[model samples]
Target chain A: MSRPVSLPRWADLALLPVINVLVAFFVAGLVVLAIGEHPLEATRILLTGALGHGEGIGFTLYYTTNFIFSGLAVAVAFHAGLFNIGGEGQAMLGGIGAGVAALALGSLPGIVALPIAVLSAALFGAAWAAVPGWLQARRGSHVVITTIMFNFIASALLVYLLVDVFRPPTSMEPSSRIFGPGGKLPFIHELIPGLPKTPLNLSFVLALLAAALVYILIYRSRLGYAIRTVGANPTAARYGGISPERITIIAMAISGALAGLMATNEILGVQHRLINDFTGGYGFVGIAVALMGRGHPVGIILSALLFGVLYQGGTELAFDKPKITRDMIVVIQGLVILFAGALEFMFKPALARLIGGRG
Target chain B: MELIDTAIGVFASGLRLAIPLLCACLAGLYSERSGIVDIGLEGKMLAAAFGATVAALSTGSALAGLGVGIVVSVMLGLIHGFASISQRGNQIVSGMAINMLAVGLTALLGNAWFREGGRTPSLEGAARFQPIALPGAEALAGVPVIGPFYKSVVSGHPLPVYLALAAVPMTWFLLYRTRWGLRLRAVGENPAAVDTAGVSVSALRYSAVVMAGVLCGLGGTYLAVAQAAAFLPNMTAGKGFIALAALIFAKWRPVHALGACLLFGLLDAVAIRLQGVSLPGVGQVPVQAIQALPYVITVVLLAGFVGRAIPPKAVGIPYVKER
Candidate 1:
């Protein structure tokens, strides 16, 4: 066997991730085939369903809005070398936060109520994540375990609040009352008249603005430099007078804040009320997005779009192909995580050999 | 007499619930002790439960179901081993992938094959693990506290319950009184030292991982075949993580793992009984608060409130050979 070699930077950044995604798709196709479905036909249907018409595109982009928030959340934590699996819990708490604010201030003007809801979402999410961060920083507890545990705790807490506290007297369902007119986010179609009516809302613009800000925060700022330094080497960072503990907590807070924004798209924009499990596994999907995007903002946007396509397409596929369920996308997501995140270096040595790099 | 019977019933139910946790916790103990962190235990158990249910439904043999469950779980464990051990990948990421994969595959396949919304047909008669009554259990039921305790708690459980009970002592003996156990512990603590002594670190870790798979398979199979008659989607329901918390609470010791799992099981049983029941001065205890207790206690314990739960020294670090 030949010794492993490094690829050129551009190829490392672009070509490798594409290969991983293609391999993931290939395995997904095989799974479809195993279920006695025609893979090519399924792919055609999926692609067409996700991108065929104006409404499909609108729905896809709406889903993309949520993914961008969550992917950015995971990426920010990755920059600080913290695996924040608590994104699911944080996002759930964020929904609760947004719901609280919207319910309380719904009679107020839209301009005043919406921002408060968004801010509350961020604060609740940050607080939810900060405890685990503080535990890891101060008490030597592993954040991964703590975050995983927090996800379950958050689920139970959500059920309790929804069933016992938030449910309306007339309703049998475990959900809060719908938000007032001021609390509702305007659909993008309302703003731009030519577009189809979909859940795509002002939150889409917020997601883009968030992506741009995250780009600046991770690359162009001094704190970004400190975060990256601490992630790369804690000992050297400490020698340079930067506190690793503080950076860990800060990065986690920022990550949690980004994750919290997902609630804006789901709760305020679409649901218009606090529903049980409104996040709908997008937080876990964010791990796949962050890994596939290689923790870059631009890459995250692109990968988020891809997942959105898969999700919208999978829903359509379920309608067309009775045997193929929506859960097929989860298999694809797992494969992407496997190939892109865990076995990321599996194809590296072979790729280097082909690209003619010197060891 | 009525109160005693209710207490006996609750204790018996607690013991039954503890069986799955006991198996998974012991499984985690082996893997973590050998320096591999397995967050995928939940996924493996879910897959095993699915496999066991499907196989038992078809073959009408509970033993065959157990066999298939173990095979399926072991295959997943090997995949984890290949990624973390041979490929030198991130163990946590690999475990997460395994978990997601199991969840998706089980649901998708179960739906495709059975068409019952991601569930197999219920097991019955020969397809399920029937409870076995001990000799003279009925005859001794007329006696006092000792007879009721012995008959209800000790007897009338399925074969797997006894097997699970026996596993605790077996694991203790294997881990403490054996040379292979010493080498396995050494590999987890210091792989370089084990490698310098000419033992294959990867080989020992793989064995430990396989052992974990076998144990999880038993727990999962028992869940479907004895405790429940059908395989439900997402049936493991975070018990894997609870077992993991119990493992930490036990501080990775075999005997302590048994105690911790039973305690958790008792908490679960009590929570179920207390639901909607108004106590003196407490007015209707919230079931959700009781349900969340295990996770909250774990977080507090992990934060060093109940002393430090130190993991294996080299745990979660992939060993790389220096060139």
Candidate 2:
């Protein structure tokens, strides 16, 4: 017979996350020792650098925008049980398309240029991602294999475009010219003072709205029910007249377009001009975000904000402490993923008990 | 009259370029055949390359460098095995962790050691790898039609070329003719079956992954000590991923992997040569397009048109035993 969770409600799910955070601390300390640094000092500096100054807060919010978009993109695929590793390539090319549009159509009004650039990016990214989705749906090809392959092909193509076709004549940076002022996103600081560089442009709000839309689309819509059923059990879903084939295509395309939104936030909102590689592996890092969030939209946002802190704070730590490379951030990032992956072992019992159940 | 001679020279250069791919792909063949993914092959090669360069620079011995490369790889292999097999972690995650570790460690150590740049000191031609031209094959240069072709195509490659060529036969014999090979195959196909038969399933799988490390080590050392006589950061680039694609394209078979490596290598060699060689109507094709040709083809092939490619049945699935 099934049993209800017998533990006190407060001591169940809430306490478990605290313990998990402590474990993350221990793991991060181990890596610090391996790299020959004082973990406490590094952690202290990392925290201070992230929120210590006005600019630090801005950096945090800026990064949170990218994380939110990428996290949702990967989560959509994860909920569909498809591992879409091609996010980086998709987002990168998406940025390129956005950049080209922004640069070419500077004559348009600010409002029109921004939306056009973002939608163009979404369209381009969708077309690029459609190749892998088609492969999986049509030929019994594995997404893992095809996505990995597409990544290399996409990066190479981007590199070629940057060096040859799009190389700006005005600057030596391996990038196109700065998008005209008309294309610039209105910074939060520009509109309001003393906001700690929130960079609170229109796009961050859009991302929050997108998160809600994704939740509604995935959980409330009929399409959402179909996708969830397919993810839970494809065979059963198929037998019930739900088409796994069609859902795979739709879900992957949606995921890719959402990934393109990150380009909009990054290039159109914050950076204003696309560089050679604007992404610091945000697309790939989003996978970890999705996993840690349990594929929940709210959870994805929480995880995204946490990762945004790491990214922003880590960059600040790099400038302040020259001895430490940006790569240490990677070690910490990897450890976070390692623990996140192992969460089932730790959380299963606690979650079970939270509902008055016994294992 | 000299067009044929130029063509012959390019083909010779192409095979030399192909050697490292062959070595990495063959090593990939072993790991994948045993049902373990070797995405870390690039990192393994990179670490081995650094090991070889440091050894050669410090010890003045190529043989010592080769030995160091293999040992370093085995150690890295154990790291992969420790996390993936012992801790029961995900294989892809473990491989990715090692790759990240290799990237940071190689750069950190290289900077500390080099003190000038993130690159080791370059060597003289004396320290560099030399081609092992068979004497009579050199005489084939003077012969009529067949002689020039044989001399240009078959002769004048470095030791690793022959080693890479020989590894195909060695892999074939080890995979089909030996008991250890059978055990490895069993582990790849189903570790539980081997476990039921009273074998240590984890031990066998670990060995297979470790073997991949060894192969990656050799492939890497061949690049730095054998090819360039120096080391640079991220030098192996995405050849490791290319090797993985080749492994899949070959369907985890040794013979097919070798052929796939050669095919990709040839395309790579051709692309590099075709760079800056403009056609009359097209003006010029960017080197990037040519360089991207291999990966583009891999994507297209993965898009389901090139025959059929299926990975091993039990690949990337961790074997958890019944308690």
DockQ, all models: 0.72, 0.33
Candidate achieving the largest DockQ: 1
Worst lDDT 10-window in candidate 2 chain A: A1-10
Candidates' C-alpha lDDT? 0.91, 0.75
For model 1, report the TM-score of its A chain. 0.97
Looking at every candidate separately, what fraction of the true A–B Cα contacts under 8 Å does it contain? 0.69, 0.30
Instruction: Give the per-residue lDDT digits (tens) of candidate 2, residues B1-323.
Output: 48777677677777766667777787777776666776677778888988988887888777678778888887877877766666565666556656656775676567545754458998545455566777788677678656777776787666667777888888888889999888888888888888999998778878787778778877887888878879988788878888877777676778887878877777777777777788789988777776767666666666657766666677777677876
List runs of model 2 lying over 4 Å from the truth: A1-31, A34-36, A163-174, A194-201, A342-359, B86-88, B112-117, B123-158, B190-200, B320-323
- By lDDT, the best candidate is 1
lDDT of 1 at B261: 93
Which residue pairs overlap in candidate 2's backbone? A4-A356, A4-A357, A5-A355, A5-A356, A5-A357, A58-A197
Backbone clashes in model 1, listed as residue pairs: none
Runs with alpha carbons beyond 4 Å of true place in candidate 1:
A1-4, A357-359
Give the backbone clash total of model 1.
0
Q: Estimate each model's TM-score.
A: 0.98, 0.87
